[model samples]
Target: MKDVPVYTKSQLALRNGQDKPQIWIAFKGVIYDVTDSRLWKNGKHYEHWAGQDLTLELKDAPHSSSVFERFKVIGILG
Candidate 1:
């Protein structure tokens, strides 16, 4: 199996849609690119923002972790 890359929070911060156009979010130590997700346009989904870990915040969300099934796993958060 190919080893996935690990990124630091500082490096991840730059990927916010506004800062670098990547629009990424982290959950359970996994980073996902949400740039093409309509719900994540401008890096804001409801009250959630991109370029940060959403591990705890997602618990109150209307959906479950399954919502991440379709998004690609870009890396692991370090």
Candidate 2:
């Protein structure tokens, strides 16, 4: 598998929850999965995962690459 691209804070907002389970992020023109991170916290900034009740807080607690590395994608939208 190839390394997922990185996205800045702005590019990610454009594609947030756009009828797709995934979207391409461009931090430095590279694409990656912002969903893979656990920085989204329910009732705070974002909602929780479907199967999970824990809200993600990327601002307060940025998601670690080691934890979300498995969810990385090349150029696909879920």
Candidate 3:
């Protein structure tokens, strides 16, 4: 398998739709590309925003973290 990329919080922030068209969210150190996800349009999902770690926030979400497994794994947060 290829090595997964690593990104810092500042680096991930640049991918936010407001700063850039790409949308990224991190959970448990894994970053997912949610740019194509209808739910993440404009980098906002309910109270969550792209380019930030959602590890702690998932507890408040209705769905489990498995929901993110379907999305593309872009990198890991370092």
TM-score of each: 0.95, 0.31, 0.95
Candidate 2 C-alpha lDDT tens digits along 1-78: 254444444444444445345443432233345564555322122433322212233334456434444544444221
State the lDDT of candidate 3 residue by residue for 1-78, as single tens digits. Answer: 169988999999999999989999999998899999999999999999899999999999999988987999998999
Cα lDDT, all candidates: 0.92, 0.39, 0.92
Alpha-carbon runs more than 4 Å astray in model 3: none
lDDT of 2 at 63: 65
Candidate 1 local lDDT, 24-55, one digit each (tens): 99999999999999999998999888999999
Which residue runs of candidate 2 sit more than 4 Å off their true CA positions? 1-15, 40-73, 76-78
- Order of models, best lDDT first: 1, 3, 2
RMSD of each: 1.1, 8.5, 1.2
lDDT at residue 10 of model 3 (Cα atoms): 99
Candidate 2 TM-score over all chains jointly: 0.31
